[model samples]
Target: MTPFVAVVFVLLVLCSSTLVAHGGDAEAGAYMLIATSSMKPKASCSGHKVAPSNEASLNSTWAPLHLVSGPCSPAYSRGTDSSSTDDDVTSIAKMLDADQHRVAYIQKRLAGGDTSNGVAGASWDGQTTDVGTYLPASNVGVGAVSHVRPISSLNKMIGTTAAPDGTSAVRQTVIIDSGSDVPWVQCQPCPLLVCHPQRDPLFDPATSTTYSAVPCSSAACARLGPYRRGCSANVQCQFGFTYTDGATATGTYSSDDLTLGPYDVVRGFLFGCAHADRGSTFSFDVSGTLALGGGAQSFVQQTATQYGRVFSYCIPPSPSSLGFITLGVPPQRAALVPTFVSTPLLSSSSMPPTFYRVLLRAIIVAGRPLPVPPTVFSASSVIASTIVISRLPPTAYQALRAAFRSAMTMYRTAPPVSILDTCYDFTGVRSITLPSIALVFDGGATVNLDAAGILLQGCLAFAPTATDRMPGFIGNVQQRTLEVVYDVPGKAIRFRSAAC
Candidate 1:
């Protein structure tokens, strides 16, 4: 439907087709040119020469074809843009053109054609020449010029098919290195100088009948021999270092010389000897005790010695094959180790052995019930004149409560009730009741008035959330306070000084 979608679909189809056509068997084919020697000269006028029955005995083989200067022939002559004509030459002088090579005529054989001049005499245009017909003049002893002619008898021969037994009856022959005198065979495989599984003993320098093992350290051993180390009286150890005993004074010795001692003891005593006497000392002090335990303990001790005292504990395994190993200061160090079965001991009362302190403090203040304490009020409002209701003093809160009571009384016995009856009937009603309302006073009412001032001062001081309002309510109160303090003309200041 879209250009991008159509392009993607076409790409998918092309890739799928390509992948199917070039399956796993895909490989590049090796191309080799088969050489031949005996072929007809321009008989069909194609680039390759066709083999004649009697002279087609040459076998096809892998060989480099020779390029030589040969006579050219006029196989096709253009009469017009679309058609061509040909003529054949039989005389030697006539065959040799200005090109300095004999030209041979080629006639395309047709069934039931005239035999005399050979079907519309076509000249052999200088092109591919037959090897047999173009043999060197010096090779022929006859001094007279060789007569050049087309062999027409080849027309009687029929094409042969190869036998099923990996043999072909029809073989092609090509002239190879014709310009050089060196004779070369065609089908023989090329000589390979490198060593292989089929051939061994590439070179033999000796004529003796006796056999002897060659010493690896000898000069002659350099020829196809194993590597060797220089002669030394010390025995080579597992780590490639030389080792000897320290007891012997003259004889060359090694760890094997001291039967009762460990290799390290022998090494220590022998290594302390002079260089020349190192290999001759066979006995060593095997009486000293060897420290075998605590490689890990030694590491820890060294660390503590370099760094300072460190406390550590080994934790028992957990039930889920997990536990912890701890080190350093008491509560500061911990390591998780998963073993088979154990429980991790976590103490809630114990404090971490770090420098930081954790303190818990409680502040108490009295106020009317709300949410958050007034101390949580924004610091920005503290510098402003706005009276945040949530941050009102206790006296201001009482004044606002009194105002609420008076407003509710006025609403119950107000003239608006009579006005409402004039518009709608409710004369049978004996009792008068109004919906309950909540009062919210502004900061100006509390900041200037006695009760309001006390409420605001109480709010400004810290009070518990059990008796105070949220910080958001405090901001709302500040806004209301601003409205009351700076009233615009014709704008009635609505204050929650009464209850509904």
Candidate 2:
């Protein structure tokens, strides 16, 4: 296994949803932001992926994060040069060394055999560490896993009233992964034996006058699901997480004051302050991760009542373009936003709610329907996660791949990269044209894959599944530049083409 093959599956805490009934649309006055951050992309035709590096520049003060209104932001400290100090060189070198160790760990575990969580139905449980271990991108058609998907940020944003230090509004850049439920930030003076090097300064709860620990008796503590810690022991709320790629972290859970809206200050904001962490798969960009999930402790689930459980994000395919995630919108207010399609979220009794799964019906390629079963993308019977339909069992994928190969027979082929097996010959070619691909989900949610998503230079952006043993995923490459609106309370997802 290699770093190029690792994907994510997150599980964690929760809180009951409660909100005051608003007479009008609770999401009426939402903020429309053009926020963005620097990200790394592959250099043209090199067939090599440049792992995401901090580069996207926002106003540093323009609309931050996903809140409709908020002074809430994560701090982003300037990056230090590796050659500046021995310590700097040491830290970077340490991370590089850890990357090799991570490879060994994953290979050893996979060799040991199946450790899938004992969950029934179509969904496979636990983490899936396949291919080259924990990779950032997978090959589209030419096996060139060169692109870094959107949804995660290089800088982390936390809720803030004013920069306590009177600096940039950003404290750190954080990743927003919807697949996982745990929300955590790196912390300082950890009560543990080790802490990973964070690009942004760690959060020192002791210095935050408003910080307070979560007690074991609280209901909020009960919904912590898998993330709740120490209630039976020290009575201090805590949590520990280990990703499939051999990354592990542990820390305390607490409440603190944070600025949510433009001027609104919220007390008792729950989050993790991880003081101890050991992992090599991190993107090396920021404080920690902001949870955009369906669990109780997840930022989305906890704030459902206030915003009608609605949130939206728009990401441009190019790292240079603007992309941002916004949270909390009322169903009544969603009408104001135009959408190309909407689909129902599949129902699940599983814990740590499946926040991204949808009911897909079929896929039409260049006007022809591929011979595939709806069961491959439906219900709890399919051993799948988000059930994108793009992902399928090995046998099914083979069939789909064959059909695609036949459909694209007209185009001359090129060399392969990563797991991406299909490509167009560029021999002296300039611009290339691609066929249209569309995914039809329930509720008439039809997403058409445009050139940007289909053609990566001369390669057809269709990569093979790592292994049938792991749960399938809908890579962000396919979802590029799309506006995905999650209406949890409404039990549906809306999608449309957007420029921001």
Candidate 3:
């Protein structure tokens, strides 16, 4: 791993203390408190705490509270094995680091302000939280391991307001992935064809003159005198083409003319080409809006121009429509602003073969007046839109998801971790294995605890069974459910649901 990866790994290992599992105590209605802190513990169990003699009391008392600060620790008392797993705590810490790094990357990208025409509030906050439940030791044989659900609730949170200068105060959530089946898609680099001014007719194959004079577009070319338009045999043409021009032409009339033949050049226009084998079946989706600041009206007007949609679209007479708007360099709302060269492609060959730039612009529009006749009230609105400039196979979705996930992993501060254990039930007839884990964050980390809470609740309420019935059994006489509780004050989130 790189140094950066090493640093992240270390940070995650430190955060894992938060995820813990309780053994026989879970069924006996026993519970524990898990606490985490940034500072070194002056004493064991100093920064945080957990409570409850049984699962019922723990749920009713600790589940809803949010934590600001304290000596955090989970309260586990059934036996030495009831404590939180070290491996789980470690995994949660890594996941948290990943989350933070992801947010940081987005914040840096948005520092210059969003020009993508999408919403600016999509920046991420580095913090995250993971909560889930696991089977008890008693359910599994004494030496057998316990099993935990593979899927847990994951949330990516960000603060959305802005500062006085129009800079956002809180980062936005640009991307969210839950290991869901629905994948993400992204555009890839396509081959580009450069188009240059057609070579002189004298250079054509039918031309008989081995040395012919051609009009020079520049002063230096004129000094070379009459010469073959595409012949290096002539000193003037050879020096001019070889030294001045970077390209060596091919065919019978080949010459070292810089202004000749197929060369790499960017045209004023851009074109897209669908695969010849795959006919055109894709469409584009575009939209625009204003990002409002203190002065709503002015903000709206300014945004409209910046987004290149201030033309016939945002004005009156015609009904308002949500559609794709071309994004310009400095992005202005004026129609045909002569700013950035932007145009849509009906087909790939409509424009030059090159990567078309993507732009995001915000604009404001007028709002309807309240009951007052003939009076106008304008409201500043942030216009955001997404366009499918090109289409790809279903595999594109998987590629996009992978890209986003990789990016997220690089940016996260705390990643999830798991621990394995074995246990037997009260009758000793049923044995089960369980894996437990936790998510930890820094002081100001803003985690989507809501999602984590829901996932924990769902797992505890639902357990897989052979009969496909509600609250079904894994084997004979064994029923399982997940029990979860989050104590924000204690800086810990815990779950202890049963698995058959």
Candidate 4:
């Protein structure tokens, strides 16, 4: 371990021992220290913290969600050729472009432009005017953006009758994307030119006797519907998935045993084994995406029988800190977490099935609600897992910008950075008080934003959509340090504070 980590580890041990000696809750104290140590010590603004709830103790079967740039990540790289601010700016630019592509893709799909009935190389005219490519043969999956996190998993050894051994199995790291429906990985036969460089080794099906291709006639293949890439000459089912940024992954639909978490082993888990995968949107460390959409092919729906179609995730407050995504709540629960609030999870027939929609009612700045019309936020807003920054319609955004700027006249303004127009120079400030912001959703469920969620690179983290017709989006930045739970069957989403 590095010197900094080693010191942190020793501090953790000491703190835990001291707390135990004082008859304090050692486990909770240790976790708090871990969370604090994950952040940069010299940060100008430390984020918010909330007490843990009983739900945390009850939940199990979770996997670590590590940022690709974090030290704890399997794909972490020490080559710091580029500064974090430069990377953030680049990521923001790419992410904003991808957001537009996502909205356009959804609009096209809702307008009856689905490619399920079309064959490969068929004539088509549905293309975005700004960005994105229309693969006449492929189903277009939207919302694959930058600033993503990955979950570690293992592939079961082929021809093994014995229990899954994580040590011997192939380990891979995949992005946990709720916007996309199909999970995929780079497989053997994918030349370096075809597949982008990834941290994990390519999955060679030849070595795994348990690997089997799905036949075109099977129900599993038919379930893909629009996602199918048509049957190959060998009668094997094929899939072609395209992102908003034109990244494509095309290969055979196959099945193999997968170990999702420590105690969660999924048998015959269907996924795309991509022979040809190419995308500049993904960095070198990312292997592929883990599907968490609401479709039948999504990981959530596929494992519904076992996991109850429920999952919860907490994004870390800082980039270097670690977070977690729990697949399912255990059979029992002690109680609900404090500051817990629930809002109805809305869905619309006009939208894609993969999206998770919610009704945003109003925006509150400094404990006072903005004067914008309620209709300004009437459009169904998506809970976008991949989007790094939240976006609002022009009307609501302007109102929020005005209110926020009015409240922050004390701090001197600095030049804008990329899409973040409102920035401040905190070079000499010792302590600062920021205006509190909150989002009031339908059913009066209010979610307060942490300092980290409110600002990015010393600027406001939110941007305005091109038009009011486009739906609003709740990005991951605003979700830091909070436990957000999605209960699909119950049609409700719960939120708890400071859950790590």
**Highest TM-score against the true fold, candidate:** 4
Give TM-scores for every candidate, taking all chains together and pairing residue i with residue i. Answer: 0.11, 0.64, 0.15, 0.77
Tens digits of per-residue lDDT, candidate 2, 185-252, equal: 77667543476554344566655555677877777777666556565366777776666555666677
lDDT of 1: 0.16
Q: Per-residue lDDT tens digits of candidate 3, residues 1-500?
A: 11100000000001112221223322222122212221111222221122212211100111111111111111122121222232244333333333233222323222343322212221121122221111110000000011212112111010112211222121111111110001011111111132112111111211111112222343333322321232334332221111111221111111111100011111110011111111111100000011121111112222332322121110000001000111111112123232212222111332211111111111011111112111111111111111101111123223322332332232222222211111111122122222222111122211111111111111211111112111110110011122221111222222232310
Off by over 4 Å in 1: 1-395, 413-465, 468-473, 477-500
Clashes of each: 50, 58, 103, 0
428-496, model 4: which lDDT tens digit per residue?
664455677788889998887656567665677888877776677787777765678888998988877
* Regions of model 2 farther than 4 Å from truth: 1-170, 190-193, 231-235, 330-338, 350-354, 379-390, 393-396, 406-415, 424-427, 456-458, 463-472
In candidate 4, stretches whose alpha carbon ends up further than 4 angstroms from where it belongs are 1-60, 77-91, 107-167, 331-334
What's the TM for model 1?
Answer: 0.11
The worst-scoring run of ten residues by lDDT in candidate 4 lies at 7-16
Candidate 1 lDDT tens digits, 1-500: 11100000000000000000011110111111111111112222121121212221111100111111112111112121111111112221122221111001111111122222221111121122321122110000000111212223211211112211212221211111101111101111112221111111111112111112233343422321111222243332101111111111111111101001000001101101011212211111110111111111111222233212231211110001111111122211112111111111111223211101111111111222233233433211111111112323333334434433332352222121110111112133332221111222222222111111111111121111222221111212122111111111111122211000
Worst ten-residue run, lDDT, model 2? 12-21
